[model samples]
Target chain A: MTALPKPQTLSLTVNSKPVSMPVPQGVSMQEFLHEWLGLTGARMGCGQGICNACTVMVEEPGKLPREVRTCITGAHWFEGKTVRTVEGHARQNADGSLTLSPVQQAFVEGFAFQCGYCTPGFVTAATVLIERLRAAPVPREAVERVVSEALDPHICRCTGYVRYHTAVRDLVLATPGLVTA
Target chain B: MRTFLLTLAGLAIGGTALAGLVFSGALNRSVVSRTVETPLTAEQIKALAPQGAKVAAAADCYACHTARGGAPWAGGMPFETPFGVIHATNISPSREGIGGWSRAEFHRALRDGIAPGGRHLYPAMPYTSYRGMTEGDVDALFAYMTTRTPMPVGNAKNGLAFPFDQRWTLAAWNFLNLPASVAEPNPERSELWNRGRYVTEALGHCGECHTPRDLTQGLRTSKALTGAVIEGLEAPDITPAGLTHMGFSAASLATFMGSGLSAQGAATHQMFDVVHFSTRHMDRADLLAMAAYFFDRDALTDEAPAVLPEPAPVAADVAARAQATYAGLCAGCHGAMGEGIPHVSVAMRGNASLRTASPSGFVRAVLAGLPAQSFPDGERMEAMPSFAADLDDAAMADLTNWMRAEWGGQAPTVQTRDVAAVRATLTTRHAAGD
Candidate 1:
């Protein structure tokens, strides 16, 4: 048997909390988030980069946003970085009650999921889409194109696509002054 | 020892240098140096190319085109079907490929079903779905192919036997069947809906396998997304009812397309192939658009209208003939009503197994006795009997046809030749597997 390398201690921000964990040499961001931290927001579908179920945003201090697939990406790649996941979308109020993010609310209201397996991935992707659309509201015709382009990496098998489309459309329309009637 | 180490280091350095040379294109020149290859300037290639041609090339048009060799687009790659094999032709610049083809002819070949030679290219080329591609995209695909390093090769001969090999018969087949002409997206629908329809119906070609086929192997448009068996496993209905059957929502469908998994079930087999090839690259919005169309489309209300209903009570003469054959051959195991004996035989009537798309299976079941199995419960079941020596093709066809007509359910006729062809192919497949 080959002698395995010693585990490395790493610190990273997940859902805004700085957490430390022992990461193996080839551990992926998704595995770390899911197995070690118990954050099941990022799904594991096709471990290859093809499926976007493991997509997560790496927040850097001053660089352009980069979306990485946690499944294929190594945990070491997230060292000293803040990663946002579906869990980060909700907030706890002063009274200890949680409020759903607009994107998450839109998904529920739009009836976006049937089996709910691919729901988290879609939510994560929609969060990213909403952020990008806020920076620059796209034309109504371009919304579908942009959303498709943005979510091209994720896969869903149920509901076909109507509800997901409606979810994104609702999110975009709800954004203040972003979408004109 | 020192000298050996030094020599090893030198060899490693040389290998890295050689790899760099190959990576940088220096080795490319040496490899092609002896070939009569006149390199065209990038500008020249671009100028001569039609729009969207480059994209088509990237889509791996050559993978199928150059399989057998000929002019590109001449058609001759063998695409295996449940019925038989269909070959793709060479789509080249030669007269056989597209040499004499006009722009309109080329457009028809790409977007329409008409070939330059006025023949209808089989749906195997996916022109049925490719028809939805914008004129610009089609133009680019044409330009890209014409500009390729044209190789002189002949079209591969089709492997189909008589009756199946008749190309002229395809014309009538196309007229009677084939998908409808591509229609522009309705402006009344959302932009997302339009784009989704464009990608799914055209570039994605989801229906090729998902949609059920008629007797002639053409897509049954009226029963779109109802369900069909492709390759071997059933392509589940993506229609709302089918979705409901599987308990998948519109969002779940989009997610599955985007990621190849849902909470309900992970994609397996041919679906995995589809997800990897097509859905993986589709954007979420486009996936949603496809989902939208699928969910909103009407359910398959028209039951296979072509299939005749079950024949009334078997004719007395036919019953007597069938009874004699059944008693002498089958009654020992299968009970009198065709209700198979428990732990001994499989019922012929109302059995899903008998009503499958390929009648060849039933023929095989009859020709080869069913194999015995030892169940976990310790119950032993007898194998089905083989009738190859006992029954001819006509008898087998008649029996199975009667079984379908009498006991199985409403389905179209199964020709004797269809049974024969399936038998031959099954033997070949079984031999290959061994």
Candidate 2:
């Protein structure tokens, strides 16, 4: 029988909290999130990076938050980096209630999802776009093109892309400073 | 905006001055004006038109003359030059094209770079190489062109600036750059070798892209086939010695030319068009002849290097980070051991880009990524997503070094600066509207 490789320490920030865990070599980010961290929100669709269904936000200091495909990328690759899964999009109130993010609320109001398997990926993409706009806002005239480019990668099997796209566009247009008038 | 205007003014003045100098220097020189005879019989046209089609394919006329999603030979495709944009002219047999053109006029255009009106053509037409075309072949090509469906698409006007738009100045440019006489067939070399040479140098005009250009933007004949950079990618040295060093045998080169894939890797970037538009359509014999000319051998040499050298050890930290990055991003498709997923991605071991000393090709592939590509044999590779935004320069350099070390048997010599340079080139190309 072949001897298995030993686990390595992975230190990173998950959501708003710091995490230091021993993860086995070559364990995917999707596996680590669902099994060890219990963040099952990032559903794996194709298991390859093609569908972008397991998309998660990766943030670095002095850099814009970017989407990293968790199904294909190894968990160890996110070591020492800050990660945000779909669960991190909402806030917990003092009364032990959940307050949905602006994008999440817009998604619900716009009826953006059907079966909701691909909703997390859509949410992550939209959230990152909002953050990016907060830093560097685009002109109002360019809002549709910008929104399309942001949401172009994620694949929705339920064919709910039009609603999802409309929700994101609406959120950006409604939010001040996201799109310059 | 002021700087741009100033630069434009300076360019106009400089170009005019150069044109003035050239015009004065060639005052006594005369253009090729000998009238050619058109004596093709109906039977001869029948015999020659198909052969002409093959010759046109070998010359890669379709790629330049045909616009994307447009009629095959109706033109309007734009070639971006250092001076300005030049659109390919309509070559179909419509009234808007060559409907009234005679055989002699067609020959003159191909051989002397002169149109029906004695207008001088820009060197972007690659007439320097085509000037060596055989009279019989030219007639055949003319016949084949006449048989094309006559689309009524008019030619777009050339968008060259002042001095370049002055077509008369091309006489001077030609005097300096054009060959004094056509290349004669060598009696000493084998018929196959000579045929290959004609196909490669005369019809194909391979050196127009592969050979480095001099100050005049004329191909450096002294270092022909030694490779040149086009746009942002290195065309790489294709000299006989270079091919041998890259482990390309005659058989392999022929296969690569005909199919666009080999043990080394698929035809990439600019070379992709060469295979897709020209070589893949060429007859197998012509492809083999081209391989013979490139390898300088008449017989088939089927051998290719079977093994790569073992990778040397690198710093532990560098190796670790690179491995993790690869596992995260590249390993899924390229395979855990760099074996590559069959028909999806190529193996890294004998990849020609990695084997080269320069990392520009490899770096560009990673940053820009390749679109899902098809082969002549109906095989295809999946699209590779670009990581230009996701990976930093340092991380890119690390990944390149690791891949080179592990599979290419190369040193960990690629640096962050090198990646930065490649990235800058891509940005520059994008700005230039490539």
Candidate 3:
């Protein structure tokens, strides 16, 4: 019998937590996060690259920020990169109780989800959007423009677009001292 | 409070305008530049084209004409339909591939079902729906295609065996029902309506499945969007009459077109493929436009009046026959009253799945049965047994007819010939792993 190949392990930071997992060759980042780590937040609506449901931020030190589709991307390709998921936002308070992040809170309050299947994707995308906006709070015209751009890849079947727009808008509006101008 | 109100109003208006501007500009940009020149110069046509062209190339067109490795677009793809198998011609740049044809001839092929040589192409080419394409886009596609390196693949002669192979009859069929120059959308309608019309007619090719076909295989305009079974898959009626429980509002249809999962049902089969390629890439406004046009069409007109159908009294013989079949096969899972078990049996009566125009699904369910499901919601899991091996065609037909007539549905009777044809096709496709 032929000798079994040695398994390879890669170290990566997920949602700010350092984790190491053994991954086979050609395993996508989406598969690695979903199957190996049990993070089902990223949905696989369409296996093709066209649907952006599996978008994830890949953070590499001293490099431009990159957003990659976990489904198409191989786990070995993200050997040392930090990845964030919707589960990462459940923050522990000073007293040790978990609190929902602002993006999560906004989503719930806005009644954004209908079927709630695509909700996690929206939350993660909104988290990214909020971070981007805080760095540069765009003009009101730009706000709509930016929101559309940020949410373009996400596909939501039930709530139509009204609730998603409402949630994102509310999140941006709630940011104190942020000016429309 | 006053200051906040004013600010909010101003922001809303400004945001709407800016968003509109950006979307319109993006659409215009995509429209204006049809071809993108890449650095690499591969002689292969598919290699040189952009992503959209590649997707278009991978379409059903490449399966046949190019099967024998002849010049691209030189028609030689053979399509087997209920009528017969017809060979597709060469569409490449060679003398055989419309080398002498002008832009009008190409447009005629797409929109009017007419070839450059003034011959009528079979409806299998989908020219009826393709004609809905905008003149400019069609021209661009032609330009991009002609620029590609021409292959010398020869055409395959049609394998059609008899009276069915007579090509002249296709002309009469075209004359009777060919779409007249891709009917221009009512200009007075909203931009969304116009866009939807273009997408539905040209790009989406909804008629390829939704519209019922005549005996000659031409689309029956009278029953447009009524829904039909294409390639074993039942293309659900997309009209607002809402055959399925999920009644699609214009907005909901737009969302479904964009995402594939609607409140009605998850996109499967060819629709799933369409969403994967075409609709998902569409901008929200375009999707909305398609929704607006479709929802506004006469196809949405309801056939059922305010009053429900008068309950049909089951004939003693019919009832006994149906009862025996149901008891032996289905009653174990679906309760005797047809109320259905919580997660096991789907009720035969009044179920939207049973009411669809195409009976292929119902027949398939009775013959081959539903696939096992282990979905998260226990409520969603359901299965049916295949009776193909067990029940004869007559018994299956009687059972289905009984279900429809007894279950408050207005669906017509299904013939055994239809069932046999669909079964044969299904078997061939299964064997081919299509």
Off by over 4 Å in 3: A1-181, B1-78, B87-104, B147-152, B161-171, B179-181, B229-234, B242-246, B268-284, B297-358, B365-434
Q: Which candidate leads in lDDT? A: 2
| DockQ of all predictions against the true structure, Cα-based | 0.01, 0.43, 0.01
Tens-digit per-residue lDDT, A1-181, candidate 2: 6457469998999998999989888788899999999999999897756778899998889988888889878888888899999999899999999999998999999999999999889999999889999999999989998899889988998999899989999889988888876
Give the C-alpha miss distance for residue A115 in model 3, angstroms: 41
User: Per-residue lDDT tens digits of candidate 2, residues B229-342?
Assistant: 777677888888777555566888888899988887788777888888999999999998888888887655557544665786677888988888898778777766787777
Candidate 1 per-residue lDDT, tens place, A7-46, comes to 8787988889999978765556777888899998888876
In DockQ terms, which candidate is top? 2
Q: Native-contact fraction for each model?
A: 0.00, 0.47, 0.00
Docking class of 2: acceptable
Query: How far in Å is the alpha carbon of B288 misplaced in model 3?
Result: 3.0
All candidates in order of TM-score, best leading? 2, 3, 1
Counting clashing residue pairs in each candidate, in order, gives: 58, 0, 20
- CAPRI-style quality class for the chain A–B interface of candidate 1: incorrect
lDDT of 3 by residue, B152-246 (tens): 65666666667546544455455556654456667677666677777676766777788888777778888888788776668878675743323
Local error of candidate 1 at B19, Å? 61
